[model samples]
Target: MIDVRAVNYTLQVAGRPLHILKNVSLQTKPSEVVAIVGPSGSGKTSLLMLLAGLERVTSGSLAVNGADLTALGEDDLARFRRHTMGIVFQSFHLIPSLSAIDNVGLALEIAAPELSQSQVREQASAALAAVGLAERLEHRPTALSGGEQQRVGLARAMVANPPLLLADEPTGNLDQKTGAMVIELMFNLARERGTAVVLITHDAALAARADRVLTMTQGELVEAAVTH
Candidate 1:
């Protein structure tokens, strides 16, 4: 679950303060998918970064799965990210040298350090299979197609079964057909696993598929009509 209250993010550009997010607030329950649709520079990605603890919130609070993200120290944020949240970026972010399985298992190996190598392998393999990438487990990112690489990224994000998933324009880099496939796979798998998802996307159709939709404009967030 996620609870963000009146969050504001400000940045220093040159000499004046630039407000990136203003009074943004939203809540999500287990297994729910919340999509954020916004124009460029509307603060959607910044909100996701804040949720992932990659950026600090200048005002208000962010609580994800019962952890007060604003109050967490640097080391604590890293540990929390490893164990409690999963993030999928616009870029796949897979290592060039690591195989798909290793890329997926790396997070698990860190979050569940007590698990044996075999156990980690087993979990990662299951996650890859769930994302329809079982046969590509041994392939590196460069060897796979765009969709396959994104599937590997999804597997990596889901392998640890974190409580919440944050995705920022996950399909932005792929073709329309490939992007649709990735979106469907992500939503179906997250729903099946009972994981809450916060998706940042510009595609209206994709945003419509979520349980709730929020629109961002000029750094403010407002509830958009749910189409379906």
Candidate 2:
């Protein structure tokens, strides 16, 4: 579970402070999917970064799965992320030299250096298969389509089986149908894995699939009504 209270985020630019989030408080339960929908410059990415411990909160109380990220130093935050969280970015951050399977396997290997290469490969292969990318395991990002690359990214995220999954504009680069399928696959796997998902996206239809939809405006959060 995740909880936030009076979350305020600000960035200093040109020697002046610009508020990105204003007293935003939110709580998401385990296995619950929450979509953040907002206009550009509304702090969606800021919120995701705050939750992921990538960006420090200006003023707020926040906790994820009982860890107080605000109090953690860089090393502690890195450890927490390695053990309990995974992120998918709008740009697939795949290493150019590593194939899809190797990329995912490398994540597991980094997390557990003691694991044998064979074990790492097996786990990575399972992750790719779970995301329906078994055949593309040997392909590099440049050799794969956008959807294929993103699926490989999903496999990397899922390989850890972390409790919290944060996706930033996951479908931003794909076609409508491909985006839909990718989003659907993400939600299905998150639910099955009982992973709490905080998805930042601009698509209403994709937001509709979440257990809750939150609208952001001028850095404020307004929880929307979910309709069946």
Writing each residue's lDDT as its tens digit, candidate 2 over 130-226 gives: 8898888899889999988888888888788899899999889999999998999999999888999999999999999998999999999999987
Q: What value does the lDDT take at residue 227 in candidate 1? A: 72
* RMSD values, in order shown: 0.8, 0.9
Question: Model 1 segments beyond 4 Å from truth?
Answer: none
The residue-by-residue lDDT of candidate 1 on 109-212, one tens digit each, is: 98899999999999999999998888988999999998898889888888899888899999999998899999999999888989899999889988888999
Colliding residue pairs in candidate 2? none
- TM-score of every model? 0.98, 0.98
Residue-pair clash count for candidate 1: 0
lDDT of each: 0.92, 0.91
Total clashes for model 2: 0
**lDDT winner:** 1
